[model samples]
Target: MKKWKAVLTALLATGMLTGCLGNGGGSTLNSESSRIYVTEEGTFQTATVESYVQQDYYNGDELKTFLEEAVSQYNGANGQNQVTLDSCTLDNGTAKMMFHYASPDALIGFTTQYEDKENQVESIAVDKLSEVYGQSESEGVTFIKADGKKADQKAVSKRGESQTVVVTSANPVTIQTQGRILFVSDNVVIKDSHTVQTTKGKSYIIFK
Candidate 1:
């Protein structure tokens, strides 16, 4: 009787451990599956898998073809929406491409398809706005404006998106729309009165 009880207890413990591990694995998988979207004004947005198609590029030829097609489609769709491939260069093994467009919206739509894994977790300074889409990091990214400079900026990440944006000064910062839980650290201030204050220095904001 004693031996049977001990065996039963051991089995129950093993089952509980397995259950906990399974739950942990599922949570991590869900987090990794989240996607980040960059807006026309160079802000990050996050969404679930159901929102957008996942982008993939196997090789250089594939990327080039995609870009060419995007430009062609944009030009054909609207007479005023013209996109030009300003420059293309290969540095070491990485390729750098510059595009010129008449409209910011058109430029964003054309480049959205290529905003995939390649641009994950990439950081860019606000001074170099041209390079924003190319180097966006998946887990998180930061944008900094030079100290004492005024900034009118916005970032839109998908709902439930987790990332970090570090501003050099909180004076010029503003939160327009929010589906994100922002944890502000030292020297950051919330200029928006509507933002809900969670702690002394922390706040939370949610958009539809």
Candidate 2:
């Protein structure tokens, strides 16, 4: 799979409800008005790497505009061709909306390829492994107790620093798994949450 898609896919798969971005991995957004407008708080870390895809570039306005408008339109009238907004909350000074949009064909193709694999990625589930991070489950991946660990699959984080906990084991089983949890705090607030990864025939369970 392409790099961008992989990152985006991971982000989508994790099912993070909501979060905005700042200079660091943990950034905050603040809003004073009852309703906050469109703003891509964090860097387009995942989407930027994907080919033929730009973070916020449309005919004129940025992709943020399109996303906000799309979300507003969808909220006004629930119908087809509308992306789903999983969560909406205020963080710092920004009003963030965690949402899911139709992934491009290239991404879909990559997903299909991985899905076709015998034990590639059938399903993923999350359990509250700790106060911060969560436990992830999949075919090859096994659940192990970890305090709070973050690894980077991409260069998103030079050290692969993440707020989520995911483990991969090299036992007889061969599977890929990822786990994530979205929360809000004074330091790092998770405005919303959504799925990180899910295939057509796959399912992910989350333990509160």
Indicate which candidate wins on TM-score.
1
What are the per-residue Cα lDDT tens digits for candidate 1 across 1-208? 3342243234333432111001111111111222222222334432211111122322445445544665677678765446665433322333334455554344345434333222122221111222332233342333222231222235323322343332222112222223222333223333232121122222222222
lDDT of 2 at 39: 17
TM-score of each: 0.28, 0.23
> Best candidate, lDDT-wise?
1
Q: For residues 1-208, could you state the per-residue lDDT of candidate 2 as single tens digits? A: 2443354345445533223222211122211111111112111111211112233311222334544564566545544433444444322333333333332222223323322121122222222334222212223222211222332323221221333322121211111112223221111222223122222332322211
Candidate 1 has a TM-score of 0.28
Clashes of 1: 16
